[model samples]
Target chain A: MKAIVHVGLKPGVLDPQGKAVADTLGRLGFDEVGSARIGKVIELDLTGDLDAAAAEARVREMCETLLANTVIESYRIELQA
Target chain B: MKAIVHVGLKPGVLDPQGKAVADTLGRLGFDEVGSARIGKVIELDLTGDLDAAAAEARVREMCETLLANTVIESYRIELQA
Candidate 1:
């Protein structure tokens, strides 16, 4: 099974890296771009004989414990068989 | 419109960051975890009057030119209206 986690900053948080990308895009002539926000996607491969529900729960715990800094960031997890 | 880009290392590329995550997970007792790979998710807000097709094409160009390191990374773009 696999767990795909998307971790992103909260809406009100400042994202310097994203701003830099947007600025670079503007300089590159991608004038249509207004803003860019960068985040992380962590993919985990699981080997145990866990069911979908169990995997989702385990992955959620992983996200809370290490994958995401919940104070300023939010994460969404998707599980696949 | 918005474009969500997922950038990840191509298979066989050495990902030390990912290795570190896996090692940490094991230390934290997430024994089911076999491997962990980290990537980037970049969300871009588009302001111009571009149709769906045009937006996708434009985003693809951005990926090829700047957003992705084509030599060792792959990117997938998703556009949302």
Candidate 2:
């Protein structure tokens, strides 16, 4: 089985990296660009011993404990077998 | 409009970051974890001037030229209104 965790900053948080990227895009002539917010994608491959529910639960726990800083970021989980 | 670009390492490419993360997870007691690949998610907000197709093309170009290292990475683009 495989799981993908997509992590993003909360809406109100300031993202300097995104701001830099947006500014660079404008300098590069993409004038229509308004803003950019950078995040992370964590892909995990696991043994098939666990069922879908268990896999999702474990992955979610991983996100909560290690993959994300819940105070300023949010994450979504997608599981594939 | 909004666009999300997900950049990931190509298959067979070495990912030291992923290896480190997987090892950390194992140390933290998530022993069932097999492999972990870390990637980036870039979210762009643009003016509604461009149509969906055009927006996608522009974002794809951005990924190819700036956001991702196409030599060893692959990117996927998603456009949302």
Going through the candidates in the order shown, the clash numbers are 0, 0
Predictions' DockQ, in order: 0.90, 0.82
lDDT of 1 by residue, A1-81 (tens): 999999999999999999999999999999999999999999999997999999999999998999999999999999888
Model 1 chain B: weakest 10-residue lDDT segment is B72-81
Query: What CA RMSD would candidate 1 show?
Result: 0.9
**What fraction of the correct interface contacts does each predicted structure contain?**
0.90, 0.86
Give the CAPRI class of candidate 2: high
Cα TM-score per model: 0.97, 0.95
C-alpha displacement of B2 in model 2, angstroms? 1.1
* Candidate 1, position A59, lDDT: 90
What is the C-alpha local distance difference test score of each model?
A: 0.95, 0.92
Q: Model 1 scores what on Cα lDDT?
A: 0.95
Candidate 1, position B62, lDDT: 92
